[model samples]
Target: MSTVVDYTTFAVGCLLALAGLISLLAGWAPTWLRHVERPRLFGAWALCLGTFCVTQLPALRTEVIKLGDPAIDACVVLLLISAAALLLGLRRPRRQ
Candidate 1:
Protein backbone atom coordinates (compact mmCIF):
# COMPACT_ATOMS: atom_id res chain seq x y z
CA MET A 1 0.00 0.00 0.00
CA SER A 2 2.61 2.50 1.09
CA THR A 3 4.92 1.28 -1.59
CA VAL A 4 2.25 1.88 -4.20
CA VAL A 5 1.75 5.46 -3.03
CA ASP A 6 5.44 6.12 -3.09
CA TYR A 7 5.76 4.75 -6.59
CA THR A 8 2.80 6.84 -7.71
CA THR A 9 4.35 9.98 -6.35
CA PHE A 10 7.64 9.17 -8.00
CA ALA A 11 5.92 8.59 -11.30
CA VAL A 12 4.03 11.85 -11.08
CA GLY A 13 7.22 13.68 -10.27
CA CYS A 14 8.92 12.17 -13.29
CA LEU A 15 6.06 13.23 -15.53
CA LEU A 16 6.12 16.75 -14.19
CA ALA A 17 9.85 16.96 -14.71
CA LEU A 18 9.49 15.70 -18.27
CA ALA A 19 6.75 18.23 -18.98
CA GLY A 20 9.02 20.97 -17.66
CA LEU A 21 11.77 19.95 -20.02
CA ILE A 22 9.40 19.92 -22.96
CA SER A 23 8.09 23.33 -22.02
CA LEU A 24 11.63 24.63 -21.82
CA LEU A 25 12.50 23.24 -25.22
CA ALA A 26 9.38 24.69 -26.74
CA GLY A 27 10.20 28.06 -25.26
CA TRP A 28 13.68 27.88 -26.69
CA ALA A 29 12.66 26.84 -30.19
CA PRO A 30 10.13 29.50 -30.98
CA THR A 31 10.78 33.10 -31.99
CA TRP A 32 7.68 34.17 -30.14
CA LEU A 33 8.92 32.29 -27.12
CA ARG A 34 12.15 34.23 -27.25
CA HIS A 35 10.31 36.80 -25.18
CA VAL A 36 10.54 36.70 -21.40
CA GLU A 37 6.99 35.63 -20.68
CA ARG A 38 7.11 32.07 -21.99
CA PRO A 39 10.26 31.15 -20.17
CA ARG A 40 8.95 32.67 -16.96
CA LEU A 41 5.78 30.65 -17.30
CA PHE A 42 7.65 27.45 -17.94
CA GLY A 43 10.06 28.23 -15.14
CA ALA A 44 7.23 28.69 -12.69
CA TRP A 45 5.87 25.28 -13.64
CA ALA A 46 9.31 23.78 -13.22
CA LEU A 47 9.76 25.41 -9.86
CA CYS A 48 6.40 24.14 -8.67
CA LEU A 49 7.15 20.61 -9.83
CA GLY A 50 10.56 20.82 -8.21
CA THR A 51 9.07 22.01 -4.95
CA PHE A 52 6.58 19.17 -5.05
CA CYS A 53 9.37 16.68 -5.54
CA VAL A 54 11.38 18.23 -2.74
CA THR A 55 8.43 18.06 -0.39
CA GLN A 56 8.18 14.36 -1.07
CA LEU A 57 11.86 13.83 -0.37
CA PRO A 58 11.45 12.74 3.22
CA ALA A 59 8.76 10.20 2.47
CA LEU A 60 10.69 8.95 -0.49
CA ARG A 61 13.84 8.54 1.57
CA THR A 62 12.06 6.68 4.30
CA GLU A 63 10.34 4.36 1.90
CA VAL A 64 11.72 0.96 0.98
CA ILE A 65 11.98 2.05 -2.59
CA LYS A 66 15.58 2.09 -3.74
CA LEU A 67 15.39 4.52 -6.65
CA GLY A 68 13.05 7.12 -5.22
CA ASP A 69 15.72 9.19 -3.57
CA PRO A 70 17.87 9.56 -6.63
CA ALA A 71 14.84 10.18 -8.84
CA ILE A 72 13.48 12.91 -6.59
CA ASP A 73 16.90 14.52 -6.33
CA ALA A 74 17.23 14.54 -10.08
CA CYS A 75 13.83 16.18 -10.41
CA VAL A 76 14.84 18.85 -7.94
CA VAL A 77 18.04 19.56 -9.79
CA LEU A 78 16.29 19.70 -13.13
CA LEU A 79 13.69 22.10 -11.79
CA LEU A 80 16.34 24.34 -10.34
CA ILE A 81 18.18 24.31 -13.63
CA SER A 82 14.99 25.17 -15.49
CA ALA A 83 14.25 27.98 -13.10
CA ALA A 84 17.73 29.37 -13.60
CA ALA A 85 17.34 29.19 -17.35
CA LEU A 86 14.04 31.02 -17.11
CA LEU A 87 15.55 33.75 -14.96
CA LEU A 88 18.37 34.18 -17.42
CA GLY A 89 15.95 34.30 -20.31
CA LEU A 90 13.96 37.02 -18.61
CA ARG A 91 17.08 39.13 -18.18
CA ARG A 92 17.67 39.26 -21.93
CA PRO A 93 15.86 41.55 -24.33
CA ARG A 94 13.05 40.02 -26.39
CA ARG A 95 13.70 39.49 -30.03
CA GLN A 96 12.03 41.98 -32.34
Candidate 2:
Protein backbone atom coordinates (compact mmCIF):
# COMPACT_ATOMS: atom_id res chain seq x y z
CA MET A 1 0.00 0.00 0.00
CA SER A 2 2.76 2.41 0.94
CA THR A 3 4.70 1.62 -2.20
CA VAL A 4 1.67 2.29 -4.32
CA VAL A 5 1.17 5.61 -2.59
CA ASP A 6 4.80 6.49 -3.06
CA TYR A 7 4.73 5.71 -6.76
CA THR A 8 1.58 7.74 -7.17
CA THR A 9 3.12 10.65 -5.38
CA PHE A 10 6.22 10.48 -7.54
CA ALA A 11 4.17 10.42 -10.70
CA VAL A 12 2.02 13.34 -9.61
CA GLY A 13 5.11 15.30 -8.67
CA CYS A 14 6.77 14.71 -12.00
CA LEU A 15 3.65 15.74 -13.86
CA LEU A 16 3.31 18.89 -11.79
CA ALA A 17 6.91 19.89 -12.41
CA LEU A 18 6.57 19.24 -16.12
CA ALA A 19 3.38 21.24 -16.25
CA GLY A 20 5.09 24.12 -14.49
CA LEU A 21 7.98 24.10 -16.94
CA ILE A 22 5.60 24.09 -19.89
CA SER A 23 3.55 26.84 -18.30
CA LEU A 24 6.63 28.94 -17.63
CA LEU A 25 7.75 28.63 -21.16
CA ALA A 26 4.26 29.29 -22.43
CA GLY A 27 3.76 32.41 -20.32
CA TRP A 28 7.23 33.96 -20.28
CA ALA A 29 8.75 33.15 -23.64
CA PRO A 30 8.08 35.88 -26.14
CA THR A 31 7.97 33.56 -29.08
CA TRP A 32 5.60 31.10 -27.48
CA LEU A 33 4.02 33.14 -24.77
CA ARG A 34 0.71 31.96 -23.31
CA HIS A 35 -2.50 33.91 -23.46
CA VAL A 36 -2.61 33.79 -19.66
CA GLU A 37 -0.05 35.71 -17.64
CA ARG A 38 1.52 34.67 -14.28
CA PRO A 39 3.52 31.64 -15.22
CA ARG A 40 5.63 32.03 -12.09
CA LEU A 41 2.67 30.96 -9.97
CA PHE A 42 2.54 27.67 -11.80
CA GLY A 43 6.29 27.31 -11.52
CA ALA A 44 6.14 27.78 -7.78
CA TRP A 45 3.41 25.19 -7.30
CA ALA A 46 5.24 22.69 -9.46
CA LEU A 47 8.38 23.24 -7.41
CA CYS A 48 6.49 22.49 -4.22
CA LEU A 49 4.92 19.37 -5.69
CA GLY A 50 8.27 18.17 -7.02
CA THR A 51 9.83 18.62 -3.60
CA PHE A 52 7.07 16.49 -2.08
CA CYS A 53 7.99 13.69 -4.45
CA VAL A 54 11.66 14.11 -3.58
CA THR A 55 10.77 13.46 0.04
CA GLN A 56 9.20 10.14 -0.92
CA LEU A 57 12.06 8.97 -3.14
CA PRO A 58 14.69 7.97 -0.58
CA ALA A 59 12.89 4.86 0.61
CA LEU A 60 12.30 3.64 -2.91
CA ARG A 61 15.99 3.80 -3.86
CA THR A 62 17.83 3.04 -0.61
CA GLU A 63 17.93 -0.21 1.33
CA VAL A 64 19.47 1.33 4.40
CA ILE A 65 16.64 2.31 6.73
CA LYS A 66 18.70 4.96 8.48
CA LEU A 67 19.67 6.72 5.28
CA GLY A 68 16.20 6.70 3.75
CA ASP A 69 14.42 8.25 6.73
CA PRO A 70 16.88 11.08 7.03
CA ALA A 71 16.76 11.84 3.35
CA ILE A 72 12.99 11.83 3.40
CA ASP A 73 12.86 14.11 6.41
CA ALA A 74 15.36 16.48 4.91
CA CYS A 75 13.40 16.71 1.70
CA VAL A 76 10.26 17.50 3.68
CA VAL A 77 12.07 20.35 5.37
CA LEU A 78 13.41 21.54 2.05
CA LEU A 79 9.93 21.47 0.55
CA LEU A 80 8.68 23.79 3.25
CA ILE A 81 11.57 26.19 2.78
CA SER A 82 11.14 26.28 -0.97
CA ALA A 83 7.41 26.89 -0.67
CA ALA A 84 8.11 29.83 1.62
CA ALA A 85 10.55 31.23 -0.91
CA LEU A 86 7.99 30.85 -3.65
CA LEU A 87 5.42 32.72 -1.60
CA LEU A 88 7.89 35.50 -0.96
CA GLY A 89 8.79 35.66 -4.60
CA LEU A 90 5.16 36.06 -5.51
CA ARG A 91 4.72 39.07 -3.27
CA ARG A 92 5.18 42.49 -4.86
CA PRO A 93 8.08 44.45 -3.46
CA ARG A 94 7.20 47.71 -1.80
CA ARG A 95 8.76 50.81 -3.34
CA GLN A 96 10.33 53.35 -1.09
Candidate 3:
Protein backbone atom coordinates (compact mmCIF):
# COMPACT_ATOMS: atom_id res chain seq x y z
CA MET A 1 0.00 0.00 0.00
CA SER A 2 2.81 2.35 0.82
CA THR A 3 4.53 1.55 -2.43
CA VAL A 4 1.32 2.31 -4.27
CA VAL A 5 1.04 5.62 -2.47
CA ASP A 6 4.60 6.51 -3.32
CA TYR A 7 4.14 5.79 -7.01
CA THR A 8 0.87 7.72 -7.09
CA THR A 9 2.51 10.70 -5.48
CA PHE A 10 5.39 10.58 -7.92
CA ALA A 11 3.08 10.29 -10.89
CA VAL A 12 0.90 13.17 -9.76
CA GLY A 13 3.92 15.30 -9.08
CA CYS A 14 5.40 14.56 -12.50
CA LEU A 15 2.19 15.53 -14.25
CA LEU A 16 1.99 18.74 -12.25
CA ALA A 17 5.57 19.65 -13.02
CA LEU A 18 5.12 18.95 -16.70
CA ALA A 19 1.98 21.05 -16.84
CA GLY A 20 3.77 23.86 -15.04
CA LEU A 21 6.70 23.75 -17.41
CA ILE A 22 4.40 23.87 -20.40
CA SER A 23 2.41 26.69 -18.91
CA LEU A 24 5.47 28.67 -17.99
CA LEU A 25 7.22 28.40 -21.35
CA ALA A 26 4.54 27.74 -23.91
CA GLY A 27 1.69 29.57 -22.16
CA TRP A 28 -0.62 26.64 -22.72
CA ALA A 29 -3.05 25.97 -19.94
CA PRO A 30 -6.59 24.80 -19.39
CA THR A 31 -9.38 27.35 -19.68
CA TRP A 32 -10.09 27.28 -15.99
CA LEU A 33 -6.52 28.16 -15.21
CA ARG A 34 -6.61 31.13 -17.54
CA HIS A 35 -8.64 33.03 -14.99
CA VAL A 36 -5.63 33.37 -12.73
CA GLU A 37 -4.10 36.87 -12.56
CA ARG A 38 -0.59 35.53 -12.97
CA PRO A 39 -0.61 32.15 -14.59
CA ARG A 40 3.11 32.07 -15.21
CA LEU A 41 3.88 32.80 -11.61
CA PHE A 42 1.44 30.12 -10.56
CA GLY A 43 3.10 27.76 -12.95
CA ALA A 44 6.45 28.45 -11.40
CA TRP A 45 5.04 27.77 -7.98
CA ALA A 46 3.50 24.54 -9.20
CA LEU A 47 6.78 23.42 -10.66
CA CYS A 48 8.62 24.04 -7.43
CA LEU A 49 5.91 22.38 -5.36
CA GLY A 50 5.81 19.39 -7.66
CA THR A 51 9.54 19.03 -7.39
CA PHE A 52 9.25 19.09 -3.63
CA CYS A 53 6.54 16.42 -3.78
CA VAL A 54 8.69 14.25 -6.02
CA THR A 55 11.55 14.51 -3.57
CA GLN A 56 9.29 13.31 -0.76
CA LEU A 57 9.07 9.85 -2.26
CA PRO A 58 10.82 7.19 -0.20
CA ALA A 59 13.30 6.33 -2.94
CA LEU A 60 14.43 9.92 -3.30
CA ARG A 61 14.37 10.46 0.43
CA THR A 62 16.69 7.52 0.88
CA GLU A 63 19.16 9.01 -1.56
CA VAL A 64 19.00 12.38 0.16
CA ILE A 65 19.35 10.67 3.51
CA LYS A 66 22.64 9.23 2.37
CA LEU A 67 23.81 12.79 1.91
CA GLY A 68 22.99 13.69 5.55
CA ASP A 69 20.10 15.36 7.36
CA PRO A 70 21.34 18.85 6.61
CA ALA A 71 21.25 18.19 2.89
CA ILE A 72 17.64 17.07 3.05
CA ASP A 73 16.65 19.99 5.24
CA ALA A 74 18.39 22.49 2.99
CA CYS A 75 16.74 21.14 -0.12
CA VAL A 76 13.31 21.28 1.47
CA VAL A 77 13.88 24.81 2.65
CA LEU A 78 15.07 25.97 -0.76
CA LEU A 79 12.18 24.43 -2.61
CA LEU A 80 9.70 25.90 -0.14
CA ILE A 81 11.24 29.33 -0.44
CA SER A 82 11.14 29.18 -4.23
CA ALA A 83 7.55 28.07 -4.29
CA ALA A 84 6.58 30.75 -1.78
CA ALA A 85 8.28 33.43 -3.81
CA LEU A 86 6.41 32.54 -6.95
CA LEU A 87 3.12 32.36 -5.08
CA LEU A 88 3.65 35.65 -3.30
CA GLY A 89 4.54 37.37 -6.54
CA LEU A 90 1.10 36.75 -7.99
CA ARG A 91 -1.59 39.44 -7.80
CA ARG A 92 -5.34 39.18 -7.50
CA PRO A 93 -7.21 38.51 -10.71
CA ARG A 94 -8.78 41.50 -12.40
CA ARG A 95 -12.54 41.81 -12.10
CA GLN A 96 -14.18 40.40 -15.13
lDDT of each: 0.60, 0.61, 0.74
Candidate topping lDDT:
3
Per-residue lDDT tens digits for candidate 2, residues 10-52, read 7887887676677556654223533324566646556666756
Report lDDT (Cα) of residue 63, candidate 2.
40
Worst 10-residue lDDT window for candidate 3 reads: 27-36
Per-residue lDDT of candidate 1, residues 1-96 (tens digit): 876776677677767666666666665333565455555466456645754664474565555255676765765675676566666656465499
Best by TM-score: 3
In the range 1-96, model 3's lDDT, one tens digit per residue, is: 999989888888888788778878975556766445566766776677777778879989788899998978867885886567566655656698
TM-score, one value per model: 0.40, 0.51, 0.73
| Better TM-score candidate (1, 2) | 2
> For model 1, what is the alpha-carbon lDDT of residue 55?
48
lDDT of 3 at 42: 65
- Evaluate residue 81 in candidate 3 and report its C-alpha lDDT on the 0 to 100 scale: 66
Tell me the number of clashing residue pairs for each predicted model. 0, 1, 0
